[model samples]
Target: MYSDYHVHTNYSDDSTYLMEDVIKDAIKMKMDEICFTDHVDYGIKKDWDEGPIEYLYGQPQVNVDYPKYFKEIESLRKKYPKITIRQGMEFGVQVHTIPRYQKLYEQYDFDFIILSIHQVNDQEFWTQDYQKEKSQQEYIEGYYQEMLNVVKKYKNYSVLGHLDLMTRYDEIGNYPFEKVKSIITEILKTVIQDGKGIEINTSSHRYGLKDSTPSRDILKLYKELGGKIITIGSDSHKPEHLGAYIDEAKELLKEIGFDSFCTFEKMKPIFHQL
Candidate 1:
């Protein structure tokens, strides 16, 4: 089945594409299913008194309006009967934000949730400010350390989104995978042990990277470690980007010795043959 699990819509503060437009585009592409994994990041600003700020790619990053979001999803589900639309969220996890996210999960019924580390100690990695004071090694290592901490503390997610996401914004260019392999192994092992999975984020090509997020080496390592739960996503924020490079991502996983990827229903994994 053709599916793109990681997608953003106008509900996410960073995206401008409307939800209906994204669904229509996926339908036109002949996708069997698509999930709206909109962003819901906490700790963007220290004080609630401060107004919205441009924290993500120069866009004002705000938390997802859950009530309105789910209501619209229900509307689209009936509006588009031919394709399956799943309710999902890309939760930017941090140690301090775990409690808030836990409450969110308890309140809503999500088909899937992608645990991601977008900020370390409230400092966004996409901006150079976070990297300014640390050496390249320190920055990369710190990112993984935060990821390890989150996986250890939180077990409410379906998969870890873009396991090596820091690479996309690393100003020093590629840090040797060997430099962080040990911690990454621990992170992956922890996720797998917790019944969680990882996603092959196809946005790497769109961002001018030569490989997908987490890279081929990481994917191979996960397979070697008996990590079977995998999902492929375009990480699309626009209509034109929907389902982009998903076939290539699936092929890459197959090359890495994975026979199938995954889909989710009510937070449980459903395997699909490649």
Candidate 2:
């Protein structure tokens, strides 16, 4: 079984799964470990006064309630001793949000952190509103350019989450990888130099994507660039999705010349043989 490092619970505005239920389900599925990496995007655009809203169009602007989040996880830790439960956060880092994230790092003791780029200039790429403004090449370049900036500025994260996440929401279908290869290479180089890594987000398969985020070609490039640190995650938000396709992700890593995958404790990488 694989350790699912990217997961969400009720603490995240988007998810409804209670933390305890997530733990119970992970145990039932025979997972070795699980981490709660709920959403923490600082500048998410939403009408907070409004009650419930749709995600594809209007994103909920919310942050994790750190005290309650950690408190519940600690209780779950003692309650479920057999499985390792790690405390983590998926930080949606924009160039402007770096200072806020720095404060968050200092305020909490997280076992892991997955730095992700969900939006740029406070505009979410998932929505058609943002996508309509730019051409395919323009949007793709803009996404990677923002990511490169974030990677260059932030060093406290364990790995980059869904490195090519824009592809999942691209209405125009696949963008030519060659167009962004040079910039992607630069981003990977920065991450490796900072001793950071990337995750193989298995949710791509669930989303009917043809390849994993940061596809096999990008994974191969990372390996060739001497970037060895890699982790696998389901990016699961519900009980049914827990540990989904994790074994297949590991096998994919092995085929790409990665003999092992990584886990984290106190933000330090630990390799596990595949």
Candidate 3:
């Protein structure tokens, strides 16, 4: 059985699909479990336009509606027992959003949380529209440093959403990891130290990154560093994308020496042997 813990619903301003739409797709895919991780960007700078890429009509309070969202998920969970459904969120980690994230952590009982780095300072560095113009080395470096801070500050999150999400823009062309591996390793070491999971985000394939977020080499490195907690996700924002290529993700993890994948319930992990 497999579980996709990173997914989004209408609650994410960018998504127009409903929670039930996601559930129905999960059923079609014969997925064992799925979590709804809608977008919850805590602090986005107002001068976002000055950044590399242009964002569509600024996302607002994808975070605030969680209380109501939780109620909806709870209702869906009861109705969709054939396929396990859980509550989770994908949080955009800005350097200054930790306090708000911590406050949310204290109040909610979620199945999982995936912390992601979508912006570098105010830049929409994760998308190609902007990253294509920046130096690959510089963009990759910023991703590591920013992610390190996130792992250090948020102790409760289950996984780091997409370790090399900067590739979403393809601007990270032919960027050699040799010069940057140390920084990546350092950030991963902190994640290991903090006892969190790093996800194998399959969405990278959709974005044209040869290796899903964090590349296979980095996955090996994460494993070598004794960073044991790992999970797999499609990072699907739509129903059709919900369980896309999960079997491929399973194969990739095994090739990387992950004998099993993880699932979450009440904020705790339950490993399933592959």
Candidate 4:
């Protein structure tokens, strides 16, 4: 049975695809379980001095209608009993947002939550803004250090998304891999120690990165370190992107000595053999 746990719907501000579009594509792909992990980006609310409550404003909401989204998925699950449609969230874990872990965890009944380091102190590394100042190697190193902080701050997510996401932009600048290996390994060790799994995201391939995030070399290092908790994701934002290049990712994992991937049910890890 093929299960894809990482998928973004209209809920993510950057993605505009409809949720059903993704589900239909999953059916075409013959996936046994398709998790709808819409992003819920929480930002600090601007409040005036001496306010009664901490006014939580600037919370970005795209297709983030959770109630409607879940209702639709629940119906789809019943109709297509063959497919398990689990609800999940992809949280952009920042320093301030990290403290709200308890509230987020308690508020939602998510089957899986992918804690990703997308922003550092309000600076989004994904955008071209940060790239102007940091070189490719420096960018990657910054990401790794932010990951170390994000992973250590909270024990909230089921897996870490795209351990080497910076490579996408790195390709443009001819990233210095020789300089990143040590810091990458250091972050992976902390993830292993903190009981979090790394995701072999296929989205990198589709993103024109020509390879998976963290690369096969990094995956091998994780395995060699006695780290068995590895999960695979397509990171697809569109319906057509569902299960995209998953077989290639699976093969890459096997080549790196991983026999299976860890799945989550109610936020708990479960291993499925490759």
Which digits, one per residue and each the tens of the lDDT, describe model 1 over residues 119-148? 988888877767888999998999899999
Error of 1 at 225 (Å): 0.8
Q: Note the Cα lDDT for every prediction shown.
A: 0.89, 0.88, 0.77, 0.73
Q: List the residue pairs that clash in candidate 3.
A: 128-169
Each candidate structure's TM-score, on Cα atoms with residue i matched to residue i, is 0.95, 0.94, 0.89, 0.86
Best by TM-score: 1
Q: How accurate is candidate 2 locally (lDDT)?
A: 0.88
lDDT of 3 at 238: 70
- Span of 10 residues, lowest total lDDT, candidate 4: 47-56
Flag clash pairs in model 2: none
For model 2, residues 150-258, the per-residue Cα lDDT tens digits are: 9999899999999999988998898888889999999999999999999999999889999877799999999999998888889888887889999899889888899
Answer with 2 or 3, whichever has the higher TM-score: 2
Q: Model 3: runs farther than 4 Å from truth?
A: 45-64, 126-134, 170-172
Weakest lDDT window of 10 consecutive positions for candidate 2: 45-54
Instruction: Provide C-alpha RMSD values for all models, in order.
Output: 2.0, 2.4, 4.0, 4.5
Candidate 1: count the clashes.
0
Q: Give the higher-TM-score candidate: 1 or 2.
A: 1
Which residue pairs show collisions in model 1? none
Output the number of the lDDT-best candidate: 1
